[model samples]
Each structure stands twice: as C-alpha cells, then as structure tokens.
Target: MTDAVLKIENLQTYYGKSHILHGVSMEVAEGEIVTLLGRNGAGKTTTLRSLSGLTPPREGRIEIFGNDTTRWPAYRIARLGVGYVPEGRRIFPNLTVLENLAVPMTRPGPWTVDKVLELFPNLGTRRDSWGRQLSGGEQEMLAIARALLVNPKLLLLDEPSQGLAPLLVREVFRVVASMREQGISILLVEQNARFGLEVADRVYVLNDGQMIHSGPARELAKDEERVRALAGVGGKEDGVLTAKPKTSAA
Candidate 1:
C-alpha cells in the first residue's frame, strides 16, 4: 500500500489468559477506507482496541503516521491524530449535544464544532438536547461528531451502523464516505457486511482470530456467496478464500 497512514504487522493480543488475535495484520492507506468484517467474537473489536492503545498488543509492530507506537499509551496515541469511535456510541448521557461535542481533546485541523455540526445537521437541530434524549441514530451521529473534534488523520470506527434502521445506516455511511474526501483515512469495524463492502475501498475478513481474505471491496462484493462465506454474514458460512491479488493477512 502507498502512503499508508496505519500499519499492523503480526499482531498478537490477549485478554487475561485467553488469546484473542493471532498474527492479524492490516493497513489503511492515506485517504482510504478499509473495513474489517467478521462474525461476533472474531477478534474484530480487539484489533481496534490494540491499535488505539487501549489494549497494547502482546507482540507486533504498530505504526501510525510512520511512527513506532506499539507501546504508547491511549492518550498519547490520540495525540498522534488518531480518532477512535468505539462501539455502543459512548456518549455523555448527561451532557447536551453541544457539550458532548466540546468534550474531546481537540487538535489543529479542519474539523471543528461548527463544521461537524454542519456535516451532521440532524445533530445541529438538537444541539440543546441531552444525549440521553437523542434517538439511536442521533446518538451515533453525536459519537462521530465528538470524535471528529479531535481533528484526526486516521479514524477508527467500530460498528457505526449497528442497531439502526436501513435509512439511517445509509446516512452514517454517507457521512463516512465524505470523511475520505476530506482526507481522513478510516479503519472501520462493521457488522453489516453489505454496507461495509459498499462503502470501503478495501476489505479484510477475519474468522476465529485469523484473517481469511483481503482484497478490493468491489472484487469481493461481486460474489454474494463469497461475501457471506468469508464474512459469515446472514449465517451462511461456506467456501474458503482462494488466492487473490492484494490480499492482506489478518
């Protein structure tokens, strides 16, 4: 990959006595979107956590913006222009929309309170509303908006489309696509394989803590059977990933 904003090599991580990720590796090029697809407990979230420094890898190399950050703390990693939007839309329920947006430790960049509000106008209308009062879509939007305030070069999004209506999912993806145009590389963990394949430039599939396939999103999206097989989406697991050009080891 050219101009890679983030790269992980032979990553191995664990939780207490349980080994989770097994030599999983992937990269996100500058201004590109790379989606991580897998069934529940495929070590998808663990990968993001490791990259964000919330859970330092047991072994591996993590380079962000060409810096060796394998042992950096979570706050230090955030300072390197990496914005992470974790699963569950972790917002300050007691804070207003405006307050929640203002909470992130910001950096010097184009993403500001007003700019993100403009990008997510639904949030703008409810600026005075408490986060707890917002709908699920609104909460998700708020979460994304809060992360953008960090003015990151790379964004890590975990399940941004989970538990939302079909139309809302499209809206979330549309916003995500727009971020690429603004030059923010994204590493997205998405449960909805179809949406992940549709919006991402490249795709990585993980099964049982191992990478099964990596290729162009368009290439994999062409075969519905292959998508379901590699990702286990819709619960129909079949077929193995054959040799494909540009495949990144998971």
Candidate 2:
C-alpha cells in the first residue's frame, strides 16, 4: 500500500460518561480498501465517528492527507476531503432525490450530480422521487452518491450492507470496489464479513473496542479457525460472521 490516506493512533472515544473505544488504532492507505470488521457493539461505528470528527476521540492522533486533524470540527474535516456515510442513510426524508443530491457544497473534483447519477442509473430514473419513497437499497445508493459529491479522497462507510437483500449486498460491494480504481481510499465498517473480506485489500478486526487483528484480507479470509476466534464463527446460511459482542458502547 502507498502512504496512508488516513491514520489513527491510540484512539479513545466516549459517549457522555461511557467509554466506547479503548486505544483503537488503524489506517487506510492511499487508494486502498480497508475493512474494519467485528460483531455488533465492537465500537466499529464509533471508530468511524472518531475519524470523521462526529464524535471526536477523547485521546488520539488522527492524520488525514498528512494533516493532523484530531480535534478539527466536522465541517473542517469534510473540507479536507474526507466523506463520511454514517450508519443510517440520513437523507432528507421530504426532499426529492435530485434535491438531496444538490445539497452538498462539494470541493472541486470529477464527481458531479450528473456523473454520480450516471453511475447509479436507478437513481437517475427516480430523480424526482421523494427520499422516503425509495427502497432500502436505493437509499443506500443515494447515501453513497451524496458522499461522492464531496469529492473525497478518503471515504468512511459504516455498515453499508445492513438490512439489504443478498443481491443488493453484492451490487453495493461491487460499486464500493470500483471506487478504488477511481483513486478513492476507503475505510469500510461492515457486519457482512464475507463481502467485507471479498473486497478489501486489508482487514482490521475489532473486539471490545480494541483492535485484535490487522492483516491482508485474503489471509484472514482463508483461515476459518482464526476468523472464528477473532470475529466469531461463520453462519451456515450466508457465511456471515456472528459473534456475541460485549455489552459495551457500540
């Protein structure tokens, strides 16, 4: 991997009085896809929040594009070319799809509303549809498209495959994989360990708010015993990793 596009060291975050992440540390290299995997409540989402400055870490160092942005405000971080698509697809419920796309005051880059619409033709066809009218998969697509309009060099995605059908999961992963070719680095938090491993160049496994494993995704994918110990055993139905997360801040 090239020099890191995003890096963190000793990241500690909290939710009011509850400490969620304990010295979590990781990185996403330039143009590489890195997946952060763990069972529910493993502080995966909190990690993304810390990186995006949504929930700034209580203690840590965060470097994006070589600038130390650990305590920068969220808007300042976004302007530095970091796009974050949070856990829920938080589009404006009453707005039209086209209206939603027009919301971001993006940095100058190759991604435009028309360009993203061309990438997601289904959305293009439903340009005038209200956000609440779209299906779950469509909403997910819209969220990702809107993130792209920020012209991000690094994208932080949280649980993108959640609540979608199997086919849609595959399609979403396909699009995510293509982003690397377009010179975008990704830090992906996914519960679908199967698809997460499939697309990632490298992997980071979180357990109890700490990083337990970090290595090439292929190495982790081929070792089922290690995967079981680190991320829990895989389900027989869809091969998803299922572990009982500790009762802590998720």
Candidate 3:
C-alpha cells in the first residue's frame, strides 16, 4: 500500500439511480503513470470522479498512500494530495491566469506560482490574462498548471486531450510524461488509446462500468488489433484507432 500512490478495490459509482461504474479496481504505483482506456461513456470519467470524491463510490474501498479515503469528500480528498483535472477545463473564468493558480494553494509543498509558470511558459506570458481570454490549448495548460500547484502526490486526469489540435495534444501528453519524471503519480482517463499507451506505464481497460483488461502499456501497444478492438475503433485509417500523433485534450 505504501508503494502505491492510489488503490481502488471493487469501486462502484452511480448517477442517481443509474449505475455507472461497477467493480472497478486499479492502482497507480509511486511515480508511475497509469491510464484507463475505454470508449465514450465507458465509465472512465466516473472512475476518476469516484477517486476524486466528486461522486463518491457507493461501494468498495479507496486508499491513498495506504490510508482509507473511501468516504472522503472532494475537498478532503484534494487536501490529502489528490489533484483532479476534470473533463472540461474548469479554470475560473472571471480570474486572471495568475489568480486562478493562486486559488488552490491550500498548504503548498514545492509547487509555487513561479514553478507553475515555469512549467507552462505560455501561461507565464499570459499571467495577467483572464482565463476566458485564453485559447482552448492555453486553457488546458492552465488547468494542468493549476492542479500541479496543489503539489499533489496523485493526479487524476479525465480526458486530458478531449478537443484539441494535433500539435497541442502532443504537447499535453509531453507535459504529462514530464510530470511522471518529476515523481508525480498519475491516473489518466483518456480516449486516445495510442497516446495513452505511449505515456502510460500501465494500462487498464474499462467497459460498461467494469475493468475488463489490465497490463503493461508496451504489451498492449504491440497488439494494434487488440487495442483497436478494445477501444471500439475500426482500423488504423480511423484517426481514433491509431494513437499516431503525440497530441490529445480533455
């Protein structure tokens, strides 16, 4: 448990009376990037939400650094060093980029405004720009920068590359890879199977609210047919089938 930054056992989540995630279980080891890959509405986001306490799981256990956090609230989970960047870039639209970075500094460790800016030079240039004024790519970088400011031990990213240009997606995945190099464990939920496999150390496949596959990323990448089938994409010609480019968005 100490070696794992996060561990979930048979996690189950729901939206009102509708069940969304069933018996979902996975782990992110220290300093590793673990990705959850699946088609749309395959419970990827719900898994992240449950772990982040946005929608607490109705059953199972959530352990962070070996401590039980199953019933913890969002804020509590966040304070425990879990930084969550949800599907949509949720920066404060009314605030400046700098202001947005300052909003989540609860009890900071190594992450400072200067550090965050250093990681995102684009944001540094637009330090005083309003969040709403930034482009989609810039907004995504800001969202990731803001999460890093929390100095999280475990980062939960939901669709980090949802809607972005090809180049921007590559840049985003590069940053995610850098985070792992810096010793930040990440649990990524992404639709781009190729990109996810490229950056992830391990991979888990979720379908219809349950995890159906789990293994090393390299192993899955080698079997293109299996990857395409699991992701529900048809072939290499389909842009979604092959994670050809380095880019992605949330």
Q: Count clashing residue pairs in model 1.
A: 1
Give residue 18's lDDT in candidate 3 (0 to 100): 99
| Model 1 poorest ten-residue lDDT run | 236-245
Error of 3 at 16 (Å): 0.2
Candidate 3, residues 21-69, lDDT tens digits: the string is 9898998899999989887788988998898888999999999987899
Better of 1 and 2 by lDDT: 1
Which regions of candidate 1 are displaced past 4 Å?
Answer: 234-250
Model 3: lDDT of residue 210: 87
* Best-matching candidate per lDDT: 1
TM of each candidate vs. truth: 0.92, 0.93, 0.92
Instruction: After superposing candidate 2 on the true structure, give the runs of residues whose Cα lies further than 4 Å from its correct spot.
Output: 233-250
lDDT of 1 by residue, 89-174 (tens): 99899999999998989999998999999989999999999999999899999999999999999999998887777788889999
Q: How many residue pairs clash in each candidate?
A: 1, 0, 12
Q: How far is candidate 2 from the true structure (C-alpha RMSD, Å)?
A: 3.1
